[model samples]
Target: MKLSKYLGYIFLLLATLAACKKDNGNYDYKELPDFYIDTVGVQKTFETPQSIGTVVITPKVVYNGSESNLEYLWRVYGTTADTLSREKEFRSVIANNPGTYTAELQVKEKTTGIRALMRYTIIVNSPRPYGWLVAYETQAGGSTDVALIRSTEIVKTITTDVVMRNIYSEVNGGPLAGTPVSIVSNVSSPAADMLFTSQTAVRLNRPDYKKLQDFNQLFVAGAPTPKPEAVMEVPFFGNHLINDGEVYWQYSGLFIGKISVDTKGYKAAPFGYAIYGKNGGFYDMLNRRFIYMEQQLSQAATYASPKAGSTARFNLGNIGKDLVYVGIGFGQNGVSSNPDTYKYAFFEDIDKSKRWFYGINFTLPDQPDLCMVDISAMPNIFNAKYFELGTLGSVAFYANDQILYNFTYNNATNTASTPSVAFTAPAGEVITSIKLLKQPGSGYTGTESKSNRIMYVATWNAATKNGKVYLLDANPTSGSLMATPLKVYDGFGKIKEMCLKPA
Candidate 1:
C-alpha cells in the first residue's frame, strides 16, 4: 500500500510540472490611467471670518483618464464629519464654531474603484475677536454668567457697541456655580482666563473661553476646601492664587505649589500685584503689614528696617491701616530707568475714617523711595465702593453709589488733587464695578492709546432687575471721562467683575 501511495504522489508532481511547462510568457497587460491633483494655485489653508459667512475653494485636477468617470466630494471634520459639497469645486458656508478644523477633498473613479484624498486646514475666527468680559450674577437664581462687549474691528476708538450676553453659558452649556467673584485674563504667552465664583474657580482657554482647569485641578494635590479668594497673573512673572488665606504659585500652567509660610492667623488681602523681575507685594490683613516674596523663591519674607538717614515715607512692616484696594496706577513719564513706575495701595484707618494712598516702586521693595499721601480729604473717599488705577499718569478712578470720581496725585509734592465727577448713572441704578480697558503690552501706540483711555463702568438697577455697561472715553492726560458714554449696553445681570480680553 505504501509503494502505491508514493507512486501516486510522484504522478501528481509530474502532472503539475507538465502544466507549468505548457504555460507561455506572453500575456495581455494594461496600465491604469495616470492621475493627480494639481496643487498649484490651491489655497491649502483657509482663514474664514465668521462675518464673511462663506468660503470658496477650487482645486485643479490633472488626469489622463476621462473626467466624466471621476466623482468628487468635500467634507469638514471637527467633532464629527459633515458633508460640504458633491462637486469638483467647494463653495459653501462654514458654520463651525471659532476654532481650528480639518477639511478633506475626495475623488473616486467609478470604473476602477480607486480613491484619492487631499486634506486642508481651516481656521474659523470669530467676528468679535476680543472685548471686555463682564461676569455677572442673575437676580433670580444667583447663578453667574459672562458677557462680551467687542467691536467689529480693531479701531482706534470703539464707536459702536456689540455685546454678546450669556457667553459663558453659550460655550459651557451651563452657568458657573455660585455667585461671580472675579474674571481675569493672563495676557502672557499661553494666555488664559481665570474665572472665580464663590464656590469654585476655573481656568479657561483664551479666545474660545473653554474650561481648561477646574478648582480641584488647579492645585497639585486637590485643594482642601473650595475657598478661592483671588487669582492673579503677572505678565512674565508667574500666576498666584489665594485660597483660604494661603497663597499658591505656578509658573505658566504648571502644578500649583503653596508658598512656604505659616499662614495660621494671618490672611492675605484679596488683591495684590506681582511685578516682573521683582519681589511680589502682598498685605496681611491680620498683621496689617506689607509682605514681600522674592522671584521664584519658596519662602516669603518681610522687608528690612529702613537705613538710618533714609527718607522713608512709611514703614513696610508696620502699616497699621486696613487695605482698601491695590492696583497698578501710573508710570514715570517715559523714564526707562524707573523700574517701579507706579503701584498704589489704598488704605484706611481701622475705623474706616481716614484713607491714605501709598505709592511705591515695585522693583525696589526694600528701598525708601516711597510716597505716601493722605487722601482722606478727597471727596467721597470713605464712601467709595470700587476703585481702578489709571495707566497714563498719577490718576485713579473711584466709584461710590451711582457716581464715579477721578483724582490725580502728585508724587513730587505728596498731594492729591481734588476729586472730579467723571460719571453719574441714572436714578435707580447703583454702580457695581469699574475697570479700565488697559490692553496688556509695552508702550502706548495705535489701539493701545485708545484702549488705555477707555473705562468700563457697570451698573445694576434693582427695580428693573437689569444691568448695564457704559463705555466711556477718558482724557489721555488728565484722566477725565467724556461727558457722555461712547456706548451703553443693557440687559445684563448684576455685574460683579470686568476684565479685558485681548485679541
Candidate 2:
C-alpha cells in the first residue's frame, strides 16, 4: 500500500507538468502593429508655403500592446541648419529663396523603443525680377562684349559681364563671322527666350548662356545657302533681319522661324537703306519700292513699286531712293482720344537740286504725293550731314562737321521756320551719330523717364584720334538745344551704337 501511494503522487506531478506545457504551447493568434508611408515613389512640387508631405501609418491598429504610446516627427534641413521640425503627419515647409533641401520623417513605438524613418529631397526656385543689358564693341579688335546693368539706386551701372568669352564657342564652335551688331533679350520669355547676338545670330539660354542653336541651322536645316553675314534687331519694332550682303531677310520674332520678308537680292551698301514704319511697311532704297507687311510673311502678293503699271498711286518719275535721307518728323494727334496718333515723315532728296520734304503724309492715301519745302530759309542747309527729329513734332536738328542747325516745321501750312545753329562742335571734329534718347519703352526698367528728355551725340576728332560722347538736354531755354554738354563720356575708341536697357 505504501509503494502504490508513492507512484500515485509521482503520476499526479507528471500530469500537472504536461498540462502546463500544452497550455503554453497553444496560444491564441494575434498580430503586432506595422507601419508604412503612402508617399513612396511619388514626386511633389511646392510653389508656395504648404505641406510638403503627409506621413501615413499602414495596418493601423488601435492603441494597444507596446504600440499604445507612439510618436511621430518630421524635419527639414538646408545647407547650414535644420530649417523645420514637426511632431505630426502633415509636415509643411516654405523656401523664399531658390535651392535644394532635405526632409526626414520618423515614427516610434515608445513602449517597445522601436522606430521607423524615411528621407526625401526637395528643390526651391525664386522668380527673377527686372534688369538691363548693354553691348560694347572694342576698337582694338572690334570684339563685342555685353554687360548686365542693375540699379538699386537712381543711378544705373554695369553689374557684370553676362556673356563673357563663351559667345564664340556657342555658335557652331567657330570664329565670329562679323562684328557684333546688337544683343537683344526676349521679354516674353526671360528664362527660355534666347539671347540674340549679332555675331552669327546665335541664340543662347538666359541662365548659363549655353548655346541653344543658330538661326542658320534652324532655318535652312543644313542647306547649301550661305549663312547670314550679320543679324541685327531693328529699333522699336523688335524685328530681326539677316543680311547676306545682298538682300535683307527679316523675321516676325525670334520665336517664329518663318521668313517674314525677303527683298530682291542686289549688291549695295553693307546694310541697305530701308526706312521701316510702325506698321510692317518699309521703303527700299535700291529698288525704289515700298513693301507693306500686313502680317508675318505677308509681303508676297502686294507691294508698292515705282515701276510702271503698279497698283500704288505714288510714283518716283526720275528720283532715286539711294539719294534720299529719311527721318520721323513728328507724331500728331488724331480724332481719337489717343494722343499722337498721326505720324508725319521727313526726307531730303539729293538730286541734281537738293530738295527737302516736310509735313508729308506718307501714310494717308489722299495725300501720298511728296511736296518740296523751301528749306532755302536755312542758311546752312547745304552742309547738313545727319539729322534727328525732336519728340516735339514741329522741331528737328541737323548736324554737319562743325555745327548743328535747328529747324522748326509748321504742320498747318506745310512750311518750315528759318534754320539756326543749335550747336557747334569743337575744331576739327564732326558728329558721328545723333540720337534723341526718349524713355526706352520696350523692355527697359530704368529711372530715366521720357519726361526727362536727353540727347546723346557721339563725335569723332580725326586729327586728335579721340572719340567722345556728349550728353545734352533735348529742350533748353538758354540759347541752343545743345549749347553746352551736360556730361561727356570719353575713353572709347568709337561709340558705334548706344542702347538703353532697364534696371
Candidate 3:
C-alpha cells in the first residue's frame, strides 16, 4: 500500500502507541554526574565597608564544554539555591552583611556524565560619616599649607536640603524651629543671567525698637532707649529652601503668616533667571501646632524689601546648580501702626549707605578642582528655587568639606572680584597662636596663643594708606594681637589679596 493512501491508518496506529505509552513515563531519568567534589570549589569573595568580587573554578569555565545535566545552583549559605535560580545573578551585598559562602550545583548528562560547581563570598557595610572635614581656603589667608576645619554641627549626618532647598540653607542648616527666621536662595539678576552662591541672612531689632520708644518717652529718668545695635541680636542664617509653602514672619506680638521673600535671578541664571521663596516654620514643641508668622512688613528699602527708595543689591556671581545663594536686604518705610517695625531693618536710618546688595553671584574659578567649584556646571534647582522656597533640604552637597569663597577672584569688577589689599597687619593679629579655629562665616583662624606668630595673607582697607596692620577678629571688638608688628610690604597698592602656596 502506498504511504499516502495508508497515511490515516498509520496516524491512528501512532496515536494508539502514544496513548498506550507507559504510565511510568520516560525512557530513563538522567542522574547528576559525580566527580569527587573538591573541598575548595570555584569561589569569590569581598571585603567589608566597600567591595568588588569574582569567582573562578579549577578548570576555567568553558562554553559548550561540560558534559553534565547542564544545571547551575547559586545559594547564599543557609538559603536554598534551588528556590532562587536565574540565568545570571549578580549578588551585590553591602559590607555590613559578611560571611563565607558557596554556590553548588548537581549536574548530570545522560549522554556523557560530567559535573562541576561554582561559589563566591561577599561582605558589605555602610560608610562611616566623618565628624570633621578639611576646609580648603580659596581666599583671605596667609598660609601656604592646608588649614584647619572644625565640625559645623555638634551632631552630624544631617541631610543638607529639607524639601525645597535654597543657597544659604544649602550651605548651612534650616531656620530654627522656635525663632521666626526666613531664608532665600539662588538669587540671580532678572536682567543679567547669573547664579547666586552666597548664603546670607537678616535679623529684626525688636528690643532696640522698644528701647527707642522708651528713650523717646524718657522723663529724664525712664529706661534708656536701646540702640539698633544694642537690643536685637536675632541672627538669621540661610535656612534650607522650601520648594512649596507660604512664608511667615515673627513680628508684631504674634506669628504673622503669608510673608515670603521673592528673589529674582535664582540658580537658573545660565538659561534665564532664578527666584526663591521662604517662610519661618514656627515649631511649638509644647503647643504642637505650626503657628505661622505675619507678612514681614518690611518698612525699609533694604535688600529684603527691595523697593523704590534704595539700591543695596550686590552681585553674588554667576552661581551654578551645585550650590545656591540667598541674601536678605532691608528697606525703609515711614512709621505707621507699628513704629517698631522700622527698627527691625537697621538700614532705615542710613546716613550714607553703599549700594552693596546682599551680594549673590555664581563664579567658576579657572581651576575648580583645585578650589572645588564649577561655576559653569550648576545643578538644576527649578522646583525648589521657585515653587517650594519654603521647603527645607540641602540644594548642594560637598563631597568632603565646604568653605565660603572657595574659588579665586578675578578683579575684573571690584565688587568681590578685587583681591583687595594684602599688606602686613599691625601686631594685633587675630591669630595669636598657630592652632586653627573653624569659624562660621570666616575660615579657620589661628588660636589665640599661636595665631599671633604665624604670618597670613590678608586684604587691607586702602587710600588712607597706613602702615599699621590690624587683625580683624571674629568679634567686632578688637581681640588679642601679636606682640610685635611684622614688617611687610604695603600690599594695598600691589595686590588686594594673595593666596599663600602650601609651604
Candidate 4:
C-alpha cells in the first residue's frame, strides 16, 4: 500500500509539470527611445555680474523621440539650490551673490521616463565690487541708507566714478532701521561689511553686499543694547565691535562666527587701532589708560608701567585724558616705510580747553612714546567736528564747520606745523565726514597709488537739504588736498560715515 501511494503522488507531480509546460505567456515588449544632449557648442561656464540685465543660455538637445514629450529644467546650486527655468533655454537674470555656483540642466522624456543631465560652472561677480561705502541718514533723520562710489578700475587710474545711492535699500528692499553711525568693511578672511546705527546693527557679505547676520545673530550670548558705536577689523588678525561702550571680539578665520564679550571689565573708547604682528590697542575710558589685547585672547591688559624711571613722554597705563582720535600713522615715505610701528593718539582735557597729540612707536616693547606735543595752538583745534589721520606723512586733517585744516607733526622735534586750509566747503554746507581712502592689507600694493592717495570729504547743507561727497587727490608728503576735487557726487542724504571697500 505504501508503494502504491508513492506512485500516485509521483504521477500527480508529473501531471502538474506537464500542464505548466503546455501553457504559453502573452505580454508585450517595447524598446526605449534614445536621446542625448549635444554639448558641442553649449557653454560649460558662465561669468556674469549681479543684475547685469539678462543672462541667456541656449542648449542644443538631440533626441530620437517626440519633441512634445521632452521636458526641460535648469537649476543653480548655491547656499540654497534654486530652480532657474523650465524651458529648453535658460533666459533669466541671475542676481546671485558674488560667488561661485553650480548650475544643472535636466532633459527628460515623459514617454520613456528617461532623463539626462549636464552641469556647468557659474561665477557671479559683483558690479560694485570695490568702492567707497557711504552710510547716511535720510531727511528728517527718519532712517538710514548706504551708497557706493563705484570705481571702474581695480588698480592704476580710476577711469570713472558713479554714485549708486540707496544701495542698502536697493538690495534689502528698505532702509536700515535707525540713524546712521558708522560703516566699516572687514577686508580680511571671510570678508564682511558692518553697518551700525542707533537702533540696530547688520553684517553684510562682501562683494555682493547681502545681509548675512543681524545684531542678535552676531553675538554668541545674546544681543546687547542697540547703542552701536563702531566695528573695527584688523586684516587677518581679528575683529572687534563696540556696543554700549563694551567690546566684543572674534578671531579671524574661515567663517564669520559669533563674538564673545571681552570680560576684562573695561569701557573701551569708540575708536581703536590694531597692528598686524602685534597686540591691538584700545583706550580704556573708565581707567583713562591704554590697553592691548592679543588676537586670540579675550582679556585685554594695560601695557607694563613704562619701565620705572624711563623718560616716557606719557604713561600708556595712565593717560588721563579723553581720547579724541587714535590711529596708525604712515610716514612721508608712503607705505614702504615702517608705518605699522608708528601710532598717534589725540586727546582733550576734561574741560576741552586743551588738546594734545601723542606720537608713539606702538611696536616697541618699552618707552614707545616718540613725542608728545600740545596741538591746541593749531587753528580750528578747539571746535573741530571730524578728525582724520593722513594716510602718508606725519599729518592730520580736522574739520571745523565748513573749513577743513591740515597740519603736519614732527615726531623728532615735538613740534607741529601751522594748520593750513585743505578745502573749504560752500558757505551753507557743513563738513559731515572726512576719511582717508586707505586699505588695510599688504596685498593691496597694486592699487596703493589710488587707494592711499585719495581723501573723501562729505558736506551737508541745512538750508538746501543736500549732501555732497568730494574725492580729492592727496599730497603724499605734505598731506595737503588738491585745490580741485577729482570728482564730486551730489544728491544724497546727510552723510554720516564713509569707508573704503577694496577689491
Candidate 5:
C-alpha cells in the first residue's frame, strides 16, 4: 500500500512538470530578422555632360547584406510627390529641370523581417555642363601629299542652350585654312554630351594622301585644294566624325531633296548619300539609272525621303565598269539603261560645310569662324519650303530646270504664319481637292491639302543593287513622315551609312 501511494505521487508530480513545460514552449514575444533600407551609397549615372536638351538621370541603388536582384519601389518628391509617382522612376529624367527634388527607393527582401530602404537627395540645383569637341590633326608628307587639309575640333562658349549633333569644323591659327575637318564622338562621355562643342578656330593641318589615296578611286570632293595647315571652318559647332564605315551628308548648295550634281546641276534622287559594300552595285530604283550603287542591310534596298526640296548629285564618269558611285539620302539610287556620260559633278564635302541654310547657318552665333558659306543673302529661310506648297495649305510651283538658283523675295511670298507678312487663311470651309487648285508641271508635285498636318515621320531606308532610295508617306498630298529605309539589292556593292530629309 505504501509503495503504491508513493508511485501515484511520483506520477502526479511528473504530469505537473509536463504541463509547465508546454506553457513555456508557446511564443509570447516574437523575435524578427534584421530589416533596413538596403542601399548605402548613391550613384549619379550622368557624367561629363556638355550641353542640355534632354538628359536622363538613372539613379543606382547600392545595397548591403545578403539581398540580391531586389525589385525596387521608387518615389519622387518635390513641389509634388503623391501625384508624381504616376510617372516618376527611380531612374528618371533629371538634371534637366532646374529645380529641387528627392528620391526614395525600397527594395523588398526575399523573406519577411528583412527589408531594405535607400533614400537619396537628388538636388538638381542647377545643370552640370561639360564639353566634348576636341582638336584633331593629321600629317602627310614626302612627294606631293595631301596634308591635314581639314579638321573638325570641339568648341565651347558660355551659353545656356546646348547643341547636340555631329559637328565638323576648320582650324584657325593652326596650319591649313581651306582644308576640311571632322570631329567624332564614340560612346564616350562628355564628348558625346550635347553641351560640349568645339570652337578653337578650326586649324587645318595636312591631309593624308594615304587616307585620300587609300580610297582615292572611291571619293572625289569638290573644293579648292589648300596646303596643309591651311584650314577652312565648317559648322559652327564642328563636324561629327563618322564611324569606320559611314557616309555623312547634308544639304548645302541645292534644294532639300536635291543635291548639287555639279556646281550648277541638280537632280532629285530617292535619297542623298550612300555606302558601298564588298562586291558590287545597287539597283537604282528612284531615277531608274543603271550604275554601281550602295547597299543597306545585306539584301534590302530602295527608299525615298524627300522634304520640300531636298536634292542629290552624281558623277557618271568617276565610277568604272567594275565599280560605281551612288548618291544617297532619301533611300535609293538608280541608273538608266541609256548610255550617259556625266563626266564630272559637284558634291558637298562633308568635312567643310554645315548647311547653306538653317538656324545656325547665318551666324555661328557663338562660333563666328566656324560659320561660312554666305547664307546671309537669304535670312530666316530654312531652304525647304522655298519650292513647296506654303504652310498656308496650297502647292507652290516647283521649277523643273533650275534648283537653288537664286534667293528672290518675289519667288516665294510670305504667308499668314509670319503675321508680319500680310496674308490670311480662309476662316471656314475646308478645300476638298488641293490638286485641282494647284497648277502643276514637273520638278515636284503634291496630292494633299492645307489641313494635312504631319502625324508621324519615317524613312524607307532600303538598300539596293544600284544604290538606295527613300520613300516617305504614300499620300504625297501633304508630305508624309514614314521614313522607313528598305534595301533593294542586285550584286556585290558597298554602302557605309545613310540618313533622310523628312518633310
Candidate 6:
C-alpha cells in the first residue's frame, strides 16, 4: 500500500512539473519593440542641382523609447561622397557636384544598442541658371581673337595667339576657328541645350560651352558637310527643324535626325522664314523667290497672296549676311493672329547705309507675306554700325562711332518713329559694340523690360589705348535717353564686342 502511494505522488509531481514547463515556455515569448524610420522608401528620391545647392533631409523617426538616447548620422556618396551631417534633423547638406548620389541615415539607440538604416537616392543636374557666358573680341597685332566672359566676370580667351587667356573658362573642346559672327541659342528645348556660332558654324553645349561634336557630326549619315555659315532652329507645325545655310537637318532628340536641302539662306527667322540676299533683293528660301513661306513642314515652298505692302521682293543691294545683327522682337501690340503683327526683323545692307525692316504676316495662309519697310530715312541713323534691339519690342538702339540713337517702332500705326538721339559717348572714345542685357543668363529672353535695363557700351580711347565698359541706365521710359552711366568698368584690355551670359 505504501509503495503504491509513493508511485502516485511521483506521477502527480511529474505532471505538475510538465504543466509548469509549458506555462514558462508560453510566457517566454514577448512582442518585439517597434522602432523604424517612418518615411516610406518612395520618398528617397532627390533632384540634383546645378551648383552647390543645399539639400535638407528630414526623415521621420519612429522610436519606442527615449529620443535623447538616439544618435543620428547621415552619409552621402557618389557625385560628392562624404559624411553629410550627424544631427537628428538632417538639414543644410551641400550637394555640390553633378551626378548620382546615394545617401544613408543611421539611427542608433545608445542604451539599447539598436541601430536602423535608411537609404535614399540623389540626382544632381546642371540645368539653367547655368551662369553667363560673355562673348567678346580682342584685337592685338592685327589679329582679332574671341574670348568668353565667365559668370564671375572673369575673361577667358580661347585663342592661343591672343595676349590674354581666360584662365577660369571651362570650355575644353577647342578654340573657335575664326571671329564669331553671332552666337545663337536653341530655345525650343532645354534637353538640347545648345548654342551655335557663325564662325565655322560650331555648336556648343550650354552647360559648359564645350563643343558638342565635330562640325560634320551634325550631318546626316555621316556625310561630309560644307562649313556652315549660320545654323538656326525653326519651330513650325509643332516640330523643330534645323537649318544650316542651304541644308536642312531635322532634330529627333539627340543623336538622330534627317539631313536634306529645304531652303537656301544664311539667316532665318524663328517663324519659319528663310532670308537670303540675292540679286539686290531679299530671296525667300521657301518660295524660291522674294516671297514668304506659306506651307508648314512641306518641302514644296509656296508664296502668299500678293498684297501691295506684303511682298518679299526688295531692291536693297548686298544686305548684311551676318544674321548676328538681326533683331526679332514683338510689336507694340500683342501677338497678332496676323503672324506678322508683332513680328519684325531688322537688317542692314552691306553695300549701303540703309536699313530694311521685314514685316511678317500670316493672317491668310494664302497671303503669307514678308513686307519690306524702309527705315533708312531716319535722321542721324548709323547705316552699318553697331545696332541692337532692346529687350522691349519696337525699340532699337544704334551706335554710330560715338553716338547712340533710339529707333522706336509704332505697332499701332505700323510705322517706325524718326530716330532720336539717345546718348553721345564720351568725346574721343569710340563705341566698339552696343548690347542690351535683358535677362540674368545667356540667350535672349526677348523680354528685357526691366527698368534696370543697362546698356553696356564698349568704348576705346584712341589717345590712351585703353578700353572701358559703361553701364548706362537704359530705361527709355525714364525720360533721359542719354542719362549718365550707372557704372563704368575700366582696366580690362580693349573690348571689341560684349555678350552677356546670365549669372
The best candidate by TM-score is 4
Model 1 C-alpha lDDT per residue in residues 114-178, reported as the tens digit of each score? 88788888899874356778999976756889888774332435656578888777667788888
Q: Report the number of clashing residue pairs per model.
A: 0, 2, 96, 0, 155, 12
Which model, 2 or 4, shows the larger TM-score?
Answer: 4
- Misplaced by over 4 Å in model 5 are 1-17, 22-291, 294-503
Comparison by TM-score, 2 against 3, better one: 2
Query: How far off is residue 168 in model 1, in Å?
Result: 1.4
lDDT of each: 0.76, 0.47, 0.23, 0.76, 0.24, 0.50
Task: Write the candidate numbers in order of decreasing TM-score.
Answer: 4, 1, 2, 6, 3, 5
Give the CA lDDT, 0 to 100, for residue 498 in model 4: 91
Instruction: Compose the digit string of candidate 6's lDDT tens values, residues 331-381.
Output: 334432233233345555555567666554333433432455577787655
Q: Rank the candidates by lDDT, best first.
A: 1, 4, 6, 2, 5, 3
Off by over 4 Å in 1: 1-101, 105-123, 126-128, 152-160, 262-265, 332-339, 365-369, 440-448
Model 6 weakest lDDT span, ten residues long: 273-282
For model 3, the local distance difference test gives: 0.23
TM-score of each: 0.77, 0.54, 0.25, 0.80, 0.22, 0.54
lDDT for model 1, please: 0.76
List model 5 lDDT by residue over 333-433, tens digit each: 11211122011111222332322321111011122111112232232222222122222222121111112111211112221121011111122211111
Better of 5 and 6 by TM-score: 6
